[model samples]
Target chain A: MPATRYRAAPAATLSIVSLDLMRAVYHRASGRTHLVSEPVPEILAALADEPLDEVALLDRLARDYAIEGDAAALGERLEELVATGLVEQL
Target chain B: MNHVFAVRIGPVGFRVGSDWRAPIDTLADLYRDYPAPEDGIPDFSVRLFARRPWRRVLRPQVMIGGDYTIPDAAPLPLSLGLLAAEMGMNLQMALAQRRYLLLHASCIERDGRAILMTGESGAGKSTLAALMMARGWRLMGDEFALVEPETGLIYSFPRLVSLKNQSVGVVGEALRGARFGPWQRDTPKGDIRHLVPDGASIAAMAEPARAAAILFPAYGHAPDRREVAPGECFVRLTQASTNYVALGERGFDTLTRLVRDVPATAIDYPDAATACAMVEEFAA
Candidate 1:
């Protein structure tokens, strides 16, 4: 349970820009632009530093951002991030 | 709107044919400074047809057709024939141009440096760019700016600047010798007019300049400015680009280089003069 890993997908680089009201993410590998807000960016920034499994990442993010949310929901958000190649699970 | 005019603007060649003589004549007079590609055929075709067989003789409407088309697009009345032809060409370029990364931007060049301005509709990019031409900056293009993917060079397209609503009057007063097409009323974009590029822009259309900066300008605001980080600029550029996704890896690499190498800023200005001042200050 403690011996799991997750990192940004191979060859996938996230370039974030600050919009007037939101954030835009450019996925270099896909040449696609995504508009995101709030914790999505905070989460990506943290994960970009080091690989962490789902549970550990949520714990770290909750501490770093002082966020209060369901662990199951955070896990689902991590699942979506993995699907979009912004994050990975190993 | 049944004469054909072949004119080359920058890297793209266009053959515009119209069923009515008025539109073709207008295009010929406006584009008299440009020359057709002597050796090769035009890259795209713009055809203005009547809505019905008898509509040409009766009320008359100009339906834009071309090598590529947007299905169920609204038709323009014959009074707006020239605007229809221009719109058709812009549409084709937006949908089909692939050799370069097409940014939905107004580009102007000076001192071997080019600055690209883009934002949502009514951003005043076109009006400011046209005004900059009056101030001695070469107008590269108003509809789209072509960036060569391999070299990261910004090539000039220099199509006629389409000014909508109050911009038409604002630009009319700003530039004394600016050439404009017939004023169009009640079009999709209200009170439209086209301003032909000056001889300088026409002569230098083939020349390419290195991209120096990118700007996102917004009108109707108190004077303000903000620096845009490269990551944000890259993302906005992808959204502003017409064919970034279609160009594949070439688009990615070229855009990456642009955002990394050039600086980006967002400026809010109330009028063209203030906007022009903001650009000069930033580029300086």
Candidate 2:
């Protein structure tokens, strides 16, 4: 069995503006502006480069950033991004 | 289309046509201080007409139609024809205007800068703006704050301030000797009256000012003030705008700049006086 993988929309498709506590992302594909906090933006940035399954995504996050939550939390955040059409599931 | 009245507010011009003369007469009186549309041509045309010929004579109802319309909008009694005309103009701007970002907020300018107040209905922003105008702040607008997406400057709309219920009396009393439109009682919003913006606002309608700060005000609450974070301001403003989604990237870029550059605060007040005092302190 193969694990599921996810990738973010291309950087050009999103116009991300950083406000102090959150980021306002304008998704050109959906024409929706979403306000996302810390881990959500971090996850999207990580997924920008390539599609990664849960374990690899978590490993990269843990190595590269100060992630506050566990694998379950990361999974939940990824689901939210996918729901908003900011991330693609494969 | 027997009667026509045209007036320019800030950067937009509206020509209102009606089957009956009364509403156009009322609009002409209320907007007398305003100039005619640029070069005598209006940017938008609003029509107040009867659904049928007999509807114009018996139980007359004013149906709002214009460059854009809600097709299913219920007609207003001829008594509320003025409101219908105003609604028609607002509908055109809210739906069709793309030259500027339309914010459902009240604004006032002073010393070359403006303060924008936006919140849910009954937030007392209109009353606050009217009161602030009486106290010498230039009334930019009550219904909508038009922001130029390119320059980020706020233009003056300076239309008649719609005063409802108790606010009608509060502002009427404060603005003694000021021109007022006829009062219509028991309407949808309740006891509605229109207050003409002061002469200075109309005279300076063409001038634009930079936005100084943003305020989310709530009436009938214990006096409290808090600083709003930029992220919260950004979210609130997106909801406050009528054409943000339609403006696409331009809207996002302009709004982000506004939220980042301007400070935002939320003020809850027990009464108009307290709200005015808090605003004065902040503006100073």
Candidate 3:
């Protein structure tokens, strides 16, 4: 069986503003400001340019960051982004 | 509605109508320093009237009504009519102000720099601002700080300062010639008094200055000060704003610009002097 693919929503726009110790995402479409940190923003940056399936997204992330992560866990994070309407299943 | 008075406070104008003439007189005397709208049109209307037809003559409960009012809001006795009028004006601004990003914060200015202070209720923002006015800084606003989205400039909304509980006496000594409205005991916010801001705020109400610093103040604590990171400041400001959600993308741009452009810090103090000194030092 093949896993479902995901991509960034057309209307969703993200602006990552950095502070001393934290980063925030301004979701233009949702009108919601979110506080994010570390690897999450890195994950968001990975997903922001283009969408990828669970395995492909993790592979993409692994190339840039030394993340010893699992596909299932990475997939869960993608689902959270999906819940926030930042990305959707292709 | 017997008496109707139109006055402009800062960028917004209000036409307050009351069933009794007393509230109007009190408003006029307290707001004597404020200028009236030039064209005679108000951005919002505050109406203080009795709900039931005979309630005016019976219990004399005055219900505060305005451009936007809660249907089930309880009434205050006639003695608190001034309180009702002021609350009505604040309600209108909170619910209807849209030209700028409105924050539930106090603002003071010196030498073209504006310092914005916001926090939860009883954070001593009002008390601190009133004290600053008594010193030398111009009180830009006591309740709502209006920030222009394009320029990131803070405008003056120097309405009457609402001093609650013991802060009333604290402010009483600071005011030089300004007199507070009659003290009313046992309101929702404990003993309350309304202090009119100094004439400088009124004279410079039309002026706008750059936002230089943002401070989140907490009262009744040992003196402590810490820098708030951009993310923390952004979230706190969104919570502080009265119309952030309504302003949408404009609000996002403005608030992001504010945190990026202006420095933010949180200060905790047990007394007004320490708080003032901390802010002055930060501003310096």
Candidate with the greatest DockQ versus the true structure = 2
Q: Per-residue CA lDDT of candidate 1, range A28-50, in tens? A: 77666666776787778778778
Q: Estimate each model's TM-score.
A: 0.84, 0.97, 0.95
Please tell me how candidate 3 rates in CAPRI terms: medium
Candidate 3 — which residues are off by over 4 angstroms?
none
Tens digits of per-residue lDDT, candidate 3, B8-52, equal: 999889999999888899999989878897688899999999878
Best of the two (1, 2) by lDDT: 2
Per-residue error for A2 in candidate 2, Å, reads: 3.4
Worst lDDT run of 10 residues, candidate 3 chain B, spans: B170-179
Q: What would the per-residue lDDT of candidate 2 be over residues B1-284, giving only the tens digit for each residue?
A: 79999999999999999999999999988888788999999999999999888999998988999999997899999999888988898899999889998899999999998999999989998999999999999999998998898999998898989999999889888899988889877788888888999998889999999999899999889999999999999889988888988999899998999999999999999999999999997676
Candidate 1, residue B190: lDDT? 88
- Candidate 2: segments with Cα more than 4 A from true spot: none
Worst 10 residues of 2 chain B by lDDT: B183-192
Rank the models by DockQ, top first.
2, 3, 1
Q: B1-284, model 1: which lDDT tens digit per residue? A: 25899988887899998889999999898888987955659999999998888998798988999999988988888999989989999999989998999999999999889999999999989998988888889999998989998799999989889999988888888788788999888987788899998899999999999988899999999999999987788778888988888886677778777887889999999888899999887456
- At residue B245, candidate 3 shows an lDDT of 87
The lDDT values for all models are 0.85, 0.91, 0.86
Better of 2 and 3 by TM-score: 2
